[model samples]
Target: MPDLEDLYREIILDHYRNPRNRGELDTPPAVRAEGFNPLCGDEVIIYVRLANGVVDDIKFGGQGCSISQASSSMMSAIVKGRTTDELHRLNRAFKSMMSIEPDPDDPAPVNGNGADIKLGDLEALKGVVKFPVRIKCATLSWHTLIQAVEEAQTTG
Candidate 1:
């Protein structure tokens, strides 16, 4: 039987090889944000839809490594249909995860609202913390999602 780490690697690879939500939205009211990891030339585009204080939809498109692709797939799976505040908290929590700054168990607290991202399978990505260069790859989707949410807030 493969160990947990090996299983995690397979999960990541599976997500990368056959991504979920790998496409563009149709004439979406959503604003798209694109992110690039200059070091690896990895790119990700995040699209978000907000309607009445809640996210109606989310999608992503990009090309990159297992880390980036898997992270993007997971992010898209979680971020859609969340409120703006929820999205912000999720964004912050993801940053904290990549930065290795906040405790995933506790999540990064958001202002005084007491809301936070509930990191799930994403925590498996913690192995990425040991690889600095791979950090950007792991976080491309998250950063792009945040940027897209910001753009939606301002222009959408």
Candidate 2:
């Protein structure tokens, strides 16, 4: 078995090598949002399917680093079956864990337990905080996801 760090590394690499929900969604009423990490040139486009005050499905398209790609994959997986409120909360938790500020009006990454978060796999990205520029790479997808959620609430 791989060591803890190794396992996390593998998780990161696996997500990078083969991302989930990478293509666009075909829904007519889907809301689209975009995120860009100017520091690393990381970018993502998020599509959210809104129905009954929930996110029916989520998808993403982007080019970015391992952290960004992996996070996007994970985000898609978790948000697909979640409500808009749940998604918003999760984003707040994620942003908190990432040490980003929590401004009420501004859309934030999830907070609290981050139910959908796998700590070890995500811990692999902890090293990113050490590199300021790379922080953007790690957060690009999450930023996109937040945009997608916000757009869903407004457009849908």
TM-score for every candidate vs. truth? Answer: 0.83, 0.83
Candidate 2: deviation at residue 43, Å? 1.4
Per-residue lDDT over 12-93 for candidate 1, one digit per residue giving the tens place of the 0 to 100 score: 8877888878888764597788999999989998877888878788878878778998999887877777776666577666
| lDDT, residue 110, candidate 2 | 47
lDDT of 2 by residue, 52-125 (tens): 97878888997877788888887787677777666666666666667676557754344454556544355566
Cα-based lDDT at residue 125, candidate 2: 66
What C-alpha RMSD separates each model from the true structure? 4.3, 3.1
Local accuracy by lDDT, each model: 0.75, 0.73
Name model 1 segments beyond 4 Å from true: 100-117
Per-residue error for 133 in candidate 1, Å, reads: 0.9
For model 1, where is the 10-residue window of minimal lDDT? 106-115
